[model samples]
Target: MIYVTGERVQAYQVRSAFFDTRWRGLDPAQVHDYLCRVADEMDRLHRELTTARTESERVRQALRQWQSRHNGCRRRGHDD
Candidate 1:
């Protein structure tokens, strides 16, 4: 059983309207172009979020590794 978060649901609702012909009205071509732009922006945001998450994970891993190494050295009485 999967649960959809409120933010995810809202985002889907916003994107769904872009595809609804009734809401899009007579200017189909214009609507298509506008939606394409929105899609591009969304893609850009996703890439940025991916990069940020990867960087954060790397920093967390590095901090853990450093702490473990420091602890090991301290245990061995290597006080400097």
Candidate 2:
């Protein structure tokens, strides 16, 4: 239910979004179907986010190792 400008939107929020019940309101079945689709998309986004985070961490670790190994390459006139 967090609807701030830049806040993260989770699947539950998408699935449980409140419908405007002041008048006839939305069709329940159609709303459920659409929410399910949107929730599925949110799940996919979360999976992609996890994958990106893992890959970013792996690349950062590799870069740290490379930097440690090549801390003084130019100063020693050695190119590898």
Candidate 3:
């Protein structure tokens, strides 16, 4: 009786979920459609998060480069 928690509901799990049919269970078609949508949204969010992380690293590297250059200039100016 696996449950669908937020952390456990990845795209793979959502696509592969198999609920046993019963006399009073929800329609499988509706469940599958909704799960597919959830999986799609999760994929979109993951891609966005990865893109943001990559961009953030690039910004940090640029900032470090600028700071190093600025510090070197300051040291040279003080020598005069």
Candidate 4:
């Protein structure tokens, strides 16, 4: 019962979708292929997101350390 709203759609949502069959309905094989591709792309994007978040956290920590050091130096009257 996963509906694709305007917001973000997860891979599982895409996989769980089913189309009702009737006269002159859309091809099922094509739908399956497209869904597979979309799911694969979503998985790849998830991995990239995880990597980017980790990198961002590392950079944030590094910047905080640098700022702390700089502030300590200024408090000691050391200009650099």
Candidate 5:
């Protein structure tokens, strides 16, 4: 029985492939395939992280702008 965790699944899968290759003396073609798959996964994860960070920053900026406006409105009421 194999239990997998989300964070380690990709690493585990790659390691498992390498271990199998070593045991069976797999050819270069199979090794290349595994490496390519790992690279593609890394690229996808990178893009996702970048997109999430960008969205978070935009939200933060918007919140700051709204807070500034709200403060200004409150000050105006106090002056009147």
Candidate 6:
């Protein structure tokens, strides 16, 4: 799995984390459940990141096109 952020790494760490038991550490089952939830949240964030990157690239392309046209018009001394 591609972990884009520290949180994703932390989530897996939590899932696999072992606690030294003097009496007993936190319940493994509960920890696993929480880790599952964190993983789900990370998945959502990753999807959002992908979408934002795609949108940013599209805007960059559009801006480049506009600049090209503007530069051409300026060269021809056209105000419009």
Specify the highest-TM-score model's number.
4
lDDT string for model 3 (1-80, tens) is 37756655567777788888999999999999998998899899888989999999999999998887787777678532
> What lDDT score belongs to each candidate, Candidate 1 first?
0.69, 0.88, 0.84, 0.88, 0.70, 0.74
- In the range 1-80, model 1's lDDT, one tens digit per residue, is 13467554233343455444676377877766676677667777878988999999999999998888788778788863
Give, for candidate 3, the lowest lDDT window spanning 10 residues: 1-10
Q: Which regions of candidate 3 are displaced past 4 Å?
A: 1-9, 76-80
Model 6 bad stretches (over 4 Å): 1-22
For residue 31, what is the lDDT in candidate 2? 86
Compose the digit string of candidate 4's lDDT tens values, residues 1-80. Answer: 65557878889878777888889988998998899899989999999999999999999999999998899888889997
Q: What TM-score does prediction 6 earn?
A: 0.70
Give lDDT tens digits, candidate 5, residues 32-79. 677778867876897898899999999999999888778777767853
Candidate 3 to truth, TM: 0.77
TM-score of each: 0.59, 0.80, 0.77, 0.82, 0.57, 0.70
Tell me how many clashing residue pairs each candidate has. Answer: 0, 0, 0, 0, 0, 0
Point out the worst 10-residue segment of candidate 1 by lDDT: 7-16
Instruction: Tell me the deviation in Å of residue 67 in model 1.
Output: 1.1
> What would the per-residue lDDT of candidate 6 be over residues 1-80, giving only the tens digit for each residue?
34466443644554565545555777767767887887778777878998999999999999999898898788899986
> Which regions of candidate 2 fall more than 4 Å away from where they truly are?
22-25
Candidate 1 pairs with clashing backbones: none
- lDDT by residue for model 2 (10-57), tens: 898888886765567778789888998999999999999999999999
What's the residue-level lDDT of 37 in candidate 5? 83
Where does candidate 2 clash, by residue pair? Answer: none
